[model samples]
Target: MTTTHISPEFTALLQSCGLKHVAIIMDGNRRWAKQKLLPGLVGHKKGVDALRTLVRFGSDHGLQALTVFAFSTENWQRSTEEVGYLMRLFVEALSLELAELHRNNVQIRFIGELSGLPEDLRKLIQSAHTTTATNTGLNLQIATNYGGRQEITQAMQALGNDIAAGKLKPEDITEALIQSKLYTQDLPDLDLLIRTGGESRLSNYLLWQSAYAEFYVTETLWPDFSPAAFEKAVQSFAQRERRYGQ
Candidate 1:
């Protein structure tokens, strides 16, 4: 995929604002397809294309990390057929795009309950992560079957086990400890969170990491979220006064 160009001044502004990590709720794939009277799967495919562009955008613009809400745990509530299609799409997309992403120096990882997915999908996800483990360009985290609440609960459970094993005391548990147990422990806290398709809610995505993230929402659907739109988001973020609760 070709990288999209943004003005150097805009890139400088992003760097000046200390934009390093970004998270996105890629919403409205189905809605985008509906609007075009196409199958929902088509919308998802287009969304994947937009994601490719996003990865390139982040790499080209020097973003340290980019996390996207790809498939949420709650998404299982959708029709069985749709869920199945999404699973297949994941397999297909990863198979097709993993090489290019690795060549671009993007480290790919899938967060969430990996045990619940099909065995084949799990293997593919693992392969993708391993293949790009050494890449140093962009840390790309794809949240599959993930939920913020569930992540916290699991972290607490792990902490409890450690305490039971005498590895840690309850008093040793801090926010930092909990954060370390999260899927994003190695990455920086979210600098910006963008939700496409006009959504205003977090919708169970990176709840802890987003505590101080500047949010940018646009009516543009996920499939149409272009690099220019992302630049606009950064521009919006640049104007904000992030006191971090002062």
Candidate 2:
């Protein structure tokens, strides 16, 4: 696709610095599939392969946390068939890949409204979480049925509950306090956020954690986003001087 490429030296520079917590808004699976005259489900399936590649790339590059937006709460508006296929694909991936992921020392975590998932999928997620709970390698956070605003709302609700129960005082609330109540409490704040499929928007992903994150948008589709493209994103992140409003 004649996209921009980053050199190996730049990739090394990216690995050496403060790119610990990286998140991706994976977009353009269906569009890629449509261009190739393939079914939408086929595109989604290919997106899974892209995810696997990114996970391994993250681990190899010594990333502490890698979060990917897999499905949004708004995805329910999609066709029933597509949604069903996605749910089934989620189940199948967990069933087939969890053991391998565990063996690789990847700690898998699903962040979002998991209660809305089918019971079997929920059980699989729970089992995967339990199985990989102690893995000390890459922190893999998958956002299924997740939204940035929804996460903030949920965190606020938890914070309010604590305050009402006399466990916390409203006056004591801080940014750190709100963070502690979040789904990503254990993870570090986002350092770099990438959006594939030529999209520039955050699309309601990681609103709270990406306050000062460097963003790299690419024209590459999610399914076609190779390790080279990933390095390019990191390269872009490495070049930026983050002042954080200093």
Candidate 3:
């Protein structure tokens, strides 16, 4: 099958933002699989392929950081088997692609609750992060078991506890301080947020980080999420005028 190739026009549209940070809420793997009469795991695997391609493309396309919402905190509500399969899939994907990502100068970072994952998978994620930390090309951040509310809550709790313990003063709790407390502390603020599967809501993805992000959503499920579709999103984003609450 031919993966959609990037067109000049799409690349031109992408120039509009200088797209320092782009986040994707990858959705609908199961639904896409259902449409194709394949098991959901197959769709997840295809999504991983798309992710690999996109990361390389982002590196070539000058995007500073690409944050992908892989699994939500609420995803734990899924069947145990499905969740287990996704964990295994993540391990397998990293196993197969780590060398290439490292070779291509991509920095892999995972943001989210690591404590909920299996010890082995957690180690795998940590190892990948450590291995790719020195690369300077694409910054690929995968949000696994992530929730916007949970992130904010955790940040707040940490700060509050710091104050209670006399490590911080309440007056020192600035927006930057809060930001530094979140999972994306070192990452750029979101410039664009793309959601697949036609979902309009944030679905608790990145609440604070996306306060000013330009939103682009589509009906394309993750398995069918093509480069062409991604280009379309960038085109749409390029045409927008950002006011930043002016």
Candidate 4:
């Protein structure tokens, strides 16, 4: 599906609302394929296409950062064949799209236990990071093998080690310090968290960063979520009043 551009008025509305960082839990790829009576892998491939469109939309719309839940740690429980196919698809997609994304000045970053990925895939991810490190357009963060709880646990562990090594005092630990240890340290906290495919739960996505994020849930599957739909979500967000804790 072709991406539809947002109107200038809507762009102005988003700016007024301070909509910058957006996170997505891209779900329902398998369900979409099942509904179409096709192999699950086909759905994943289509989801990649949707992702490409989303990245372009974010860049064109001047979004600060777009974080996508590409692959969760729990996904490792899927059938071996399906998991293998996904790994291969990641490699293929990155190889095919990295150059174009870099040319568009999108800074690509992967947040997760990247050490657990296959060596070839890790190398390609590293290459994508290095290639787009200096880009200033869109900050594209892909969470592969990531879980919010896991991320927090790792950060706490790091802090503990620092304290044990005399590099930090227990009293020095603060929210800011913990934030600095997260994978998304330098990025802005999520302003909007969207979950496609009708799921209401976060399923262990950016838990900490989404503390006060406005959520937009849709029945549209990941493969079928168009930019126009995203525009609607952001419009909905712009209509809301975020009081943080007020």
Candidate 5:
């Protein structure tokens, strides 16, 4: 597996493109832990740390928004104990990071269903979103219990309901309207998507919004995905000449 690297030419290109947004699938945490003989929860913990580091990277690089696939709706199939640990970890993250996030002007938003989450967790997420809503810094989005299919389905259902209520016409349903209904309604579409862990598949991520995104895959795993590694992904993205099916 070839490791990615940054070059001056690539840096010029990324600067030219003006990095607006970046989305990532924080993959390979479980594999990282299994290789180290560490508990699965330890991997998740490190994954969070990686996320924090990447968030700061995005900030320093002038990116406006970042989205991460933190937990998928399908992830519920994991053992209950692990799932429970993740929920508690999430709460801890909120408690510890919300202030720092606010201090940095990073607005937080959680995509996907929150109704099924623990009442306290749901409250914590809501408070974070509300408190940071006015921030103009990086719009950090975390997808928890999120599935692209479900996101699309829910957006369609919302449109259908609006149409049935004499609020919209079939012809009024434009691409922009549908996009506005997505979890990332106000966020820019993904410009680059980085997935680590050697997984070539999307594994149920942001399919609709990433139609034209540049993909950079690696086997480094999330825990070891350092800032230099992330910069390398950006460098790869900058080297690409996107034609968008032209």
Candidate 6:
């Protein structure tokens, strides 16, 4: 989709409503490349660019946090070659852009089962996290090999283990206690959840944190989801009345 110029009125409206935490389910990379008659990897690379743009935009707009669904646990079922290429691309992107990201004061974090990743890649992610931990800018969280069910299950297991060890009791399992054990404990609950590529399903994203989030689904594919598309989502969010089960 072609990007339109952002208007001052639109920006003011978004700011007025206050979008503190925004999450995105980025979809349609391979499909985008197929439609363009380009390699699938090319679409993935472009998706990375789109992420960079959104991250920068969020930071500039005074957003506190931005979480993106990157590689999901289900994505492992894809072809080995594509998965390998994605891993390599992830490492390359981190190496190439981490310094600029740090300079921009973005705190980089990865949330998922990272133990299954390559040692080199894991080390790089750790290094990036450590290097940017002190940044005061946008809290950038990337969900790689992440699943909502797995996160909740892990939290439950941790709570159970604590109870077994006598460090806690079964009665102590409150909603806050469960949230404290989740990967997103440090961030606020999701304020807005945007999905690209025309898909409307949550697809096992931040299911727990998004209990009251405003959802914006766009037909624009991930690679083609421009800043204007993001602006449009913000506009839609600004117009919503979040009753939060009231």
**What is candidate 6's local distance difference test score?**
0.89
Candidate 3: 10-residue stretch with minimal lDDT: 1-10
lDDT of 3 at 83: 94
TM-scores, each model vs. reference: 0.97, 0.94, 0.93, 0.96, 0.93, 0.95
Return the clash pairs for model 4, or none.
none
Q: Write the per-residue lDDT of candidate 4 for residues 10-85, one digit (tens) a residue.
A: 6676688899899999998999999999999999999999999888877877888999999999999989998899
lDDT of 3 by residue, 1-88 (tens): 1223545655555665566889999998888889999998888988988887777777766678899999999999989999999999
Model 1: clashing residue pairs? none
Which lDDT values do the candidates have, in the order given? 0.92, 0.88, 0.86, 0.92, 0.85, 0.89
lDDT of 2 by residue, 1-246 (tens): 111333456446756877789899999999999999999999999999888877876675567899999999999999999999999999988898898888878999999999999999999999999999999989999999999999999999998999899998989999988999888999978999899888788899999898999888889999999887887787777778998968
* Higher-scoring candidate on TM-score, 1 or 6: 1
Model 6 weakest 10-residue run by lDDT: 1-10
**Model 5 bad stretches (over 4 Å):** 1-14
Model 2 lDDT, residue 72, Cα: 98
- Give residue 198's error in model 4 in angstroms: 0.7
lDDT for model 1: 0.92
Q: Candidate 6 has what TM-score? A: 0.95
lDDT of candidate 1 over 122-239, digit per residue (tens): 9999999899999998999999999999999999999999999999999999999999999999998899999999979999999999898888999999999988889889989999
Ordered by lDDT, highest first, the candidates read 1, 4, 6, 2, 3, 5
Q: 1-246 in candidate 5: lDDT tens per residue?
A: 112343555445557876677889999999999999998889999998888877766655556889999889999999999999999999998888898888878899998888878888999999998999999988999999999999999999999999999999999999999999998888877899889898888878997888888889998999999978977888777778988768
